[model samples]
Structure formats: C-alpha cells, structure tokens
Target: MNSFLAIIGRELRIGFADLHRVVTPISFFAVVLVLMPLGLGPSPQLLAKVAPGLVWVVALLAILISADRLFGDDMKEGSLPQLMTLSLALPWVVLAKMLAWWLMAMVPLAVIAPILGMMLGLSTEAAVITFLTLLIGGLGLCLVGGISAALTLSTGAGGALVALIALPLYVPILIFGSAAVEAASLGLAVKPYVLILLAFDFLAVPLAPVAAAAALRIAIDD
Candidate 1:
C-alpha cells in the first residue's frame, strides 16, 4: 500500500518535472480542434453535427500520441526493473503509473473538452456530455493504452506501434463516447451510452494493469 502510493507520487513528480510531457498532448488536442473547423469550413450546422465524433476522435489520437511515453522513460532510466523487483506487485505499480498518467494527460483533456466542444458548435448540453464521457472514457483509454505501451516498450516502435495495437481496442470507447454526446445534442437519453462507457472503465481498471504488467515482464525478459 505504501509502495503503491509512493509510485504514484513519484510518477506524478516525474510527469510534472517534465512539463513537455504534460503539455504536449493538451497542446496537440487544442491545435487539432482549432484547425479542424478551418479545414472543414465554417459551417455551424455541419460542425454541430460532427462535433461529437470529431472531439472524441481527436482526444483519442492525443492520448495515443502520448501513450508511448508512458513506459519509455522508466524503461530507459532503469527504474522499471527496479519497480518490478519491488515488494508490491507489478500490477499495482503499473496501476499507479496509469493513475498518474490519467491525471496528467486525460484530466486536462477532460477539463477543456467542453470548451473545445462548444467551439466546434456543440450545444451546451452536448458539451457537458462531452466532458462527462471524456472523464469516464479517458480512464479506459489510459488503461488500455498502458497495456500497449508496456507491450511495445522494448520494440523501439514508439507511437506508431502503440496506435496500431490500441486503436482497434479504442473503437468501443470512441463509439460510446461519441454516441453519448450525440444523444445529448439531440435531447435524447444518454444513459445507455454512458453506462456502456462506465462498463468499459470497470473492466479496464482491474484487468488492464494485470495485462500490462505481464507485458512488462515479457518486455524486461526479452
């Protein structure tokens, strides 16, 4: 228990120490949202219709872009091997790292998502739904992405491999998240989609760390 909290604190400190790691994803997220309207032309109706999907897609990409770095620094610095040898289980350590990554990467995106959604022409209700869905779905993204990051840690493939491995898994979250926002936009019940996103997180939270830990073991062994 002490070790787990220590790992989380250490990861958070490391993440904030390198502000680029924390800022890059959010910057990418904002830049893409800003440029998308220009590329698609300034049609409010069109933007409103596509805003849910666009926001979810861009957010997923931003997470993927940062996923490779999740384990990269630890692995390079020899901290990962040290972590694996700790008294606490590797899965717990992995979960701690994932929690830190979620705080650093996903939380910022979630906080700003509603603002960006409005800029994309989403109604106030839909923008609120976008924020809600992001908070739920982004944790699932971080967990699943952590698995890919662990699996590909020794590959030297970076974000390309992380995206390839994680994108197919990301489909469900993307679908449900976009659906929730869209339903909100149309004044429809978003409960079902929100529930589905919650289900994904429940499954991912416990399972993803174990899978990622196993991958980390394999990564270290090879």
Candidate 2:
C-alpha cells in the first residue's frame, strides 16, 4: 500500500538523519566483539567454542540499545499521536517503521557478524550458519524490540525497562540462533533449529506490529 511505503520511507529518513543513531549500535557491537578476546584470555579454542553464543548475545544487546530510541523521540516530540491519526492503519504504520529499522540497523549488524565470527575464530561453516540464523532471527529481534519500545514509549526510564522487558522475550531467538550455529559446527543438521526460528519469525512478524500499535495507542492516551 502507498501508506505503508510512505511510512517506511519516512522512518528511513528519520533513522539516517542522525548518523549517531546507526553508528552507536554498530560501534557497540564491534566493541563487544573486541572485548571478548581481551577479557576471556587468549584461548582460540575457547573463543571458537563460545563465538556463536557470544555473537548472538552482542547482537541482541545492540538491538535492545537501539530499540530504546525507536519510538521515544516520536513520543516526546508529539508526532506519535499524529501518526496514529493517519489514514493508514496504525499497525501497518508500526510495521513499516519496524521494517525500516531492520533494514537500516539489523542489516549492517548481520553483515558484520560473519566477519566478526571469522575474527573470533569461528569455522567457515559456523560463520555461514551465523549469517543465516541472523538473517531470520534478526527480524524477530526487531519485532520484539518494537513491542518493547512501544510499551515503554513515554516512560521516564526507558532504557533499562526496555532491556528488562525485551531480554526475556529474546531468549528463545538466542537459544535457537546459537544452537543452529553450534549444530553446524558439530556437523549436525541445523534444519530443526532453523525451522524453529522460522516458526518464531512467522508468529512474530504479524503479531508484533498489532501489539505495538495497541501499546502505542495506550501510551498516547495515558
């Protein structure tokens, strides 16, 4: 629909309008990857073994950090209410914004994840698996993050609250995403875990926007 596309375009403009918004997460992701080698000692075997989980954890955290700003600024600036009044359905608008966020934020993170995995000593198969899982799982992260962002929209303390609300929900994606790579590393079939992840994505992609729309409406009324 024209409205959905317009909303997506608008969100992309807002997202890139400030370079820091995109840079902060990528920088944080890189910094976390860098710290693992330093903090965990110089054990390549150890790093390789933990790389899958570590990458997923860092990516999840980066997503959370960005989610805090997803709607907070709009709420503060009073544009959210106007958006809600638009001709397009609020859920569609929310979905468009989330889609834009995923393209702008998650894509870059996903792209670097494999390279970072290689730097951390992940096997070629593991790195490829990491990339595949992230491609699917990252959307789920955006969906959940959108819901959290909407829920805590106008709350004075959003950052910690968003993490607390989103982290628990993120566990399933983390588990399956890391498990897929671990299975690949062990020469086991990753299809089951990947399927599980796809199931979550199927559920999340539709449900999140509607839930976020409801949360945003409640936020505006309050």
Candidate 3:
C-alpha cells in the first residue's frame, strides 16, 4: 500500500513537472471539440446527432497523444528497469503511472466534456452521460494505451506508433461510450451501454497493467 502511494506520488510529480506540456493533449481535445461544430455547419440537430461520436473520437486521440510519454522518460533515465526490479509488484507500479497519466491527461477532458456536449447541441441528459462515459472510457484508453506505450518504449516512432497500436483497441470503448450518450439523448435505455463499458473497465483496470508490466520488462531486457 505504501509502495503504491509512493509510486503514484512520484508519477504525479514527474507528470506535473512540465505542466505546460502536460496540458497539450487537453488543449488538443478542446480544439477538436470546438472545431467540430464549426466544421459541421452549425445544424443543431445534426450536431446533436453526431456529438457523442465526435467527443469520443477527440478524447481517444487526446489520450493517445499523452500515452507515448507514460514510460518514455523513465526508460530514457534508466529508471524503468530499476522500477521493474523493485520488491513492489511491477503491475502495481504500472497502474500507478497510468493513474497519474489519466489524471493529468484525461481528467481535464472529462471536466470539459459537458460544456463541449452542450456546444454540440446535446441536451443536459446527454451531456451528463457524455461526461460519465468519457471518464470511464478514458481509463480504458489509458489502460490499453499503457500496453502500447510499453511495447513501443524502445521504438523510434514514439507517439505515432502508440496511436497505431492503441487505436484499434479503442474502438469498442468508443462505440459503447458514444452509444451511451446517443441513447441518453434519445430517451432510450443507456444502462446496457454503460454496463458494457463498466464490465470492460473492471477487466482492463487490473489486467492491462499486468500485461504492460510484462511488455515493459521485455522492452527493458531488449
């Protein structure tokens, strides 16, 4: 427990050290959200119809933008291998890093999603649903992104490679998240979509770090 807290604190300090750069992904998320209504010609009905999908796509991309850095610094400083050697479980360490990443990268997007949804003509109910979905879906994004980030820790392509590796895995989460918001907007049952997302989150939250820890070990060994 102490190790987990320490890991998370260390990650948070590192993440916030470059606070301006750390917020770049959030800025991109905001730009995408703001641009969509302009690009789509300002039709309220049309914007509302597409708002859920647009938000999910932008949020996923924002996460991808930050994911590549999750392990890059540690690997570069040779601290990743040292972390791997710790008495604490490597998976927990990975999870701690991911949690810090999520807070830095996704929390801002989650916070702004409702405002963006409203701008896109989504109703109050839809906006709320969008916020919830974005928060949960963001976790899944970081989880899957952690694996890709670890896999590409030694690769030259960096962020592009992380996107390519993680994007396919993001599809199901995007579908379910968008569906949940769409359903809420239409006065349909949304619990099913949210449930699917929760089920995946529950599975991914624990399992992804384990897989990522293994991948990081391999990357370090190579």
Ranking by TM-score: 1, 2, 3
Candidate 2 on 95-206: residue-level lDDT in tens?
A: 9989988988888998899999999988888889898899899999999999999998867678999999999999999999999988888889999999999999899989
- TM per candidate comes to 0.98, 0.97, 0.96
Estimate every model's Cα lDDT from 0 to 1. Answer: 0.94, 0.90, 0.88
Estimate the lDDT of model 1: 0.94
Report residue 166 deviation for candidate 1 (angstroms): 0.2
Question: Per-residue lDDT for 137-195 in model 3, tens only?
Answer: 88899899999999988774788889888989999999999999999999999999988
Residue pairs in steric clash, candidate 1? Answer: none
Candidate 3 segments whose C-alpha is farther than 4 A from its true place: none
Which of 2 and 3 is the better model by lDDT?
Answer: 2
User: Cα lDDT of model 3 overall?
Assistant: 0.88
In model 3, the Cα lDDT at residue 30 comes to: 89
